[model samples]
Target: MPPAPDDRPGPSRNLAVDFCGVSRSYGRVRAVAGLDLRIAEGEVVALLGPNGAGKSTTLDMVLGLTDPDTGTARVLGTTPADAVRHGRVGAVLQTGELLPHVTVGELVELVAALHDRPLGVDDALRTAGIGDLRSRRTTALSGGQVQRVRFAVALVGDPVLLVLDEPTASLDVASRAALWETIRGQAQAGRTILFATHHLEEADTYADRIVLLARGQVVADGPVTELTGATRGRTLRATVPGADLDRLSALPGVRTAEARGEAVVLHCTDSDRALRALLSTGPSARDIEVTGADLTDAFLALTADPPR
Candidate 1:
């Protein structure tokens, strides 16, 4: 059966994809239930979760590859699967099932031909960061190279909403960073993007917003800041030889005190207050390095069991 229609009601007036109380099951297994989400036009959102957390299921529903048992998934004002049939959506699944017999250039041309209107081969190659790989046969390319080719294919059609499922799953660190830039560029060009990933730090750094899922449920959803809201503030990591970790933990306004090598990571509720207190402690306090709470720490704190 085809996925649900994309004209479902949404929270935003400009939502590109909106899901309302959506549920999907596999007989005895309830993979996802009552998941409500709204992604606006031109916004890049990351769906983050552990294995079996329903990340792939959600993407499949959005891309029209899987039908939801109940509720609806709307893509750009039409049904998801129908939208794809109309050439309104493009997606790159984790496994890029490109035709092994075709050359990258040939497959690209074929895809571009599907749209009466499409960006040319030269443009598509340039945009996908694989201009040099065009002549290479799909069978000969490295896993990372093939993923780029898949990205090219997904982008060649020029759909309004691009859904990428673990596009960087096979890529090395550098390739992943480059793809992040590519996705960011696309978002800046006014295309809405929804990608699922387990790279916690990458999601924090690159996503305009993040949706946290676990055990096939929408445990949390919002901008990185929204989930990381309460964890905001300054941090002080100091390497002090004379200090007692227990004594430092007792200091006022110290959110957390952990030993990092010989240094103590002291996250502060207020930098000014913490800095003043540190200075009064000793001359070695000058070694205290003040920093901000980054997304990594925020992610850990939010997903941590103690938070909720």
Candidate 2:
């Protein structure tokens, strides 16, 4: 007997996700506006935006939890819902209560049973770094442990594309590190990963590319280095007791100055000139370090509000 259409593999495509002219709204608020994005297969892309900036809405559309009012969203060369039904898309969402009274292993097994080509329960648990927690009840797990269980559930499907929304939320430093290590391994295995995170450093370090949303649209999209390099300035940090921020801001090369305790941070177009001026003046700056703009700087610059 032949397999059903849905049971067959999707056509091969270089892009894992493609959204064109997509828009969505709730009441009078527009969540996403003509957003066009494309993520290549095997790429680890970070989706970044402030609260209410449409990150969640966009992810929801991709997961087929919500439909766009216009345009289209395709995953794995098919509609999002179709891809999901074929067990080609897996997600680790931020919200949702685990099944009560079920052991971690049981919950994972149950999810795996729904998929046509799910990974082994033990393999999923091991991949998610929760092999030992299989016997623990879901209700008895810690926040981090619950997150790991969610990861296991998502991995059980062995999806071609993974969507993670705040995957490291509620996790401690060590747990966060462990989860990212697993994620990196999965990415290396040729799975496409799309994750949204508030941790700027995580995106800066892990993502192969970044797509930043603002006011329901893409404001910046590029490699981490490319976006940060576009910010076009150096940040100088130095210890200057009783620093006068106004004076520092007035420096020929300085664009802005902010004081943090005994240290003053200067955003400068010309760090060499700024450093010379700072030292020549009375404050007696010391322990100076000048570095180029980073992801945080790029994010702030790109997401700032537009003038009326």
lDDT per residue (tens digit) for residues 118-142 in model 1:
7787788788899998888889988
Who wins the TM-score comparison? 2
Q: Put down candidate 2 lDDT per residue, 1-308, tens digits, no spaces.
A: 11233432233537788999999999999999999998878778899988889998999989999999999898878899999999999999979999998899999999999999899999999999988998898999899988889888888999999999999997999999999999999998989899999899999878888889998999988778878888889999999987888988999789999988888899999999898899899557788999999889899999999888
Model 1 lowest lDDT segment of ten? 1-10
Q: Candidates' lDDT values, in order?
A: 0.79, 0.89
The model with the greatest lDDT is: 2
Model 1 global lDDT (CA atoms, 0 to 1): 0.79
Model 2: CA > 4 A from native: 1-13, 240-243, 279-284
